[model samples]
Target chain A: MALTRDDVEKVSLLARLQLTDDELNSMTEHLSQIIQYVHQLDEINTDDVAPLAHTLDITNVLADDVVADCLSREAALQNAPQRDEECFRVPAVL
Target chain B: MSSPETQPMGGTPYAVVVGLEVHVQLKTNTKLFCRCPTTFGQPPNTQTCPVCLGLPGSLPVMNRHAFELSMKTALALNCTIPYFTKWDRKNYFYPDLPKGYQTSQFDLPMSEHGHLNIFSENDEFADKQIRILRAHLEEDAGKSMHDEAAGVADSRIDLNRTGTPLLEIVSEPDMRSAAEAKAYLQELRLILLYLGVSDCNMQEGSLRCDANVNLHIDTPAGTIATPIVEIKNMNSFRAVQRGIEFEVGRQYTLWQKDKQVLGDMPKQTRGWDEGAQVTRAQREKEESSDYRYFPCPDLVPVVVTDEEIQAMQQQIGTLPASLRKQLLDDHQLTAHTSAVIVNQGLGFADYFLALATAIDDSRLAGNWMQGEVLRILNEQEQTIQQFKLSAAELGELLKFIQSGDLDNSKAKDVFAVMIESGQSAADVMAELGIEKVDSSQLEELCQRLVDNNPKIVADVQSGNPKAVGALIGQARKENSNVDPGQVRQICLALIEKL
Candidate 1:
């Protein structure tokens, strides 16, 4: 299936991405090609095989509910682009 | 335009349809996927780590205890546990979410097809079974604090609550009114509390709810259904009822003007502005496809066994509904009295059981629990666990009344002193100068009253039984230790001999 300009635009909007007209056209072509390449798997016959959730042959990989060490407030906020004294600051959501 | 009628289409009847989605935080020590403590009211960012913060190289793992707690809750709610369950990544863009996607369950959930019965003894609402569609476990996002008072355009993010384990239970639209919705919430909260799975504290955000509401109007032009609106930000159960009521009215008014049907408009999202008591439209509801849910490859799927499910079922000891029934049947208590005890939570119910069993009189124990025990709990703002007098001790005090050593009023005086000094009932009675008059002494006193009040004795022999009231008052004035009831009985017997 070919991806249209509108599909690319909608995807970008959901991802909060901004694209110029030229970039949009290129992205539309690139995404369509990628979809076409992935669609080749539809040719395989796997009626008997069950769908795989994970590659590993394992299940129920869990940890006990125990508290360990946590990063200090200073260390946690060190990598924030903008921060107040104790919290990471972002643009107003509303 | 023609003037709209005061009522919708000349008083056409309508029924409100409501479905609720409740999120309860599991009482786990650590985060769902990490070792960070899930403590509330901590300093901002102090509990953050690479896993919860969604660092590039960090991998997520499930907490075994959290999963077990969720299963326990679902089982208590009568949900069926699926053998296989997998986690999915729900993609979204929000500042509060450190990860670009939230880890949730999509096609396969932990449990499904459960039902909870909501009823009130007073018949405030009809008894109905609220059907549960599904219950899934997910991670909670961080909190975003926007300071309007500071007049800042920036919002501060607190990651302390990030990655907390949350079990979201979705119910079908089975509620017909606001009162049923509130009852459903109360019953659900009570069950969660009984299972010890979640604190179910609304003030601390341990429990939160969102409601989807709409109306079905019966008009001359067939049934007109309104668009479903999802309401959020209801801090209390009362707010939930009021919000749904407001939404129903709002939808009816809008339908009167435009006659818009269900599919005429997309589903909307609204927030309950509690101060104004109005539901303000927040935004258009997002379609489920927009989230683009896909199975997460980072975590392996969980396969539960039959034995594990049975173990969880056993772990959930008597829930509130069954316990309420047990109290009514075993103790032969009135429906109102049984409901009062069970609704105080498991601790208070346990106290009542211990007291009733110790004294071997449920009626007496139930009365004391509903009257004195509950009154003390409310007056001092204390829980049953924090109560000064233990059930065993209270039972010992009530035994005095049972044995006719002390009357009800005198026993209350002893109970007061016992609570204050932590003394035994006998000790408190002695200290209060309330001596138990022996049967011989009581008989002698009655005989003297019988002889002195010959007129009263004649009146009683003539079938004027109430004439014994004055003699009993005289007996009490003579020996302050005598019980009024015992005095009356003895006086009647002595007068009968005449």
Candidate 2:
């Protein structure tokens, strides 16, 4: 189902969102309508049908076992909302 | 069900059921639905586009390369290529998934019913092949990186990897051991390389694995076990191994307590703590997540003809399995030795073959490679491509092994110079004064050994031929070039005369 204001608020809470009530209500309506449209596919018989995972048949893709350049400390930290000398700063996740 | 302490010993004939889901990024010049350059390690957020960032009006246009790589990966996995495949939006909300919905293959995935050939490196273990259920294409989420510098205050999102195209390959629950899992991942990585797909860097989160593990315990009614807990986002081989080990044991322990869950509850997602060797809980009650999957109205279904599949198959070249088998037979290596040779990327394997072609003794080239070359590269934590030694210099070194001038032992010293000075192997041998001693000189030295170890010589005189091995060892210490096998033959004859 598309996210409704209630659905949005529920998911936001599940996802630890601190949204305003207006944002929650708007998101719930938006989500419900989207879900309604997505549910239309349920009419088709898919029980016997295998779920599709890829669009192409190609397989065996590999990376060369070589090390290349990585972001410098400055580059990695450039866009951090907050940062220190070596890494990004974050609120206590614990 | 298995008992905790007694489980390891008296466990009944229980089957090991395993399923694997592999995520691989496609090699594209840009993000899957955006033109934000798909280069790794770019400045964070600098690579983000409005579409990748999920700006209100920005819509996703599929990257052709992403689809091509997905199809290529499916074909290589020996999957049944779908005649018609389409994309769906798996609606979910996570800060990492900026779009709040992942554009993935759901009901009409790209490929299905494929298998990868997985033969163990160890001859002691039985060889087995497992089937890959399917491999699908999807978009990757950005990273929710905690600040390294501001460790106490705030969290940030760097969308460098956002919208990166990924192939989600799910395998039938068939793997049995950590070694088998590692081998599977290794083979999979090479296939990507051969196809020239994604860079597949685990360090950069391009190639990441979440191992699903559970143990079945035998009971009179039937074998039963707890639901499989999935271990996720492991970045290294060792981590994969450790993660699997922990989950397998955890499942077995739950079974031992008669807590084997037959269906939904036991299966949950877990994350690995590499330092502690324990798999911590990430999410629970997650047998199959219901995103209420539906086809994305934005994208069209991708259809391919048989001709296109055949053409791609023909264009595809040698893979790791066949190449490994060829090398073992043609090069006369132990199966164990050849397995290690293949584990190193196909490029490294080809480099060895190229060097071997120029040398007189190909086996020696393999030996030197399996030994000194790997050692040096490992010591420095460098990849083969990063090795300062050129292939030509390695070729020269192999030549020295071929000639009578430098025996295998002396060749080690010769290798040092060649690696550093970039000199010819022969020249290094000469400069180091490691030329083989004359046969006549060796024979003369052998006589002295016959005289010195008289007791051993007496034993050989009495027709105990094994005693001559001791003399051969003494002679070899004095001269590295002296062939112990040849000296063993000679010392026996001389002792008979005595």
**DockQ of all predictions against the true structure, Cα-based:** 0.86, 0.13
Among incorrect, acceptable, medium and high, the docking class of model 2 is: incorrect
TM-scores of all predicted structures: 0.93, 0.77
> What would the per-residue lDDT of candidate 1 be over residues B13-99, giving only the tens digit for each residue?
788889999999999999999989999998889998999998899999899999999999999889999999999999988888999
On residues A8-90, what C-alpha lDDT tens digit does candidate 2 reach at each position? Answer: 66567655679897877777777777788889998999989976545445423323232224345466456557655643444
Question: What's the count of clashing pairs in each model shown?
Answer: 0, 58
lDDT of each: 0.90, 0.73
- lDDT for predicted candidate 2 compared with the true structure: 0.73
Q: Which consecutive 10 residues in model 2 chain B have the weakest lDDT in total?
A: B1-10
| Candidate 2 to truth, TM | 0.77
Candidate 2 residue-wise lDDT at B489: 69
Badly placed stretches (over 4 Å) of model 2 are: A1-94, B1-13, B123-125, B147-154, B177-179, B193-196, B255-260, B264-267, B285-289, B380-382, B386-401, B433-492
The weakest ten consecutive residues by lDDT in model 1 chain B span B1-10
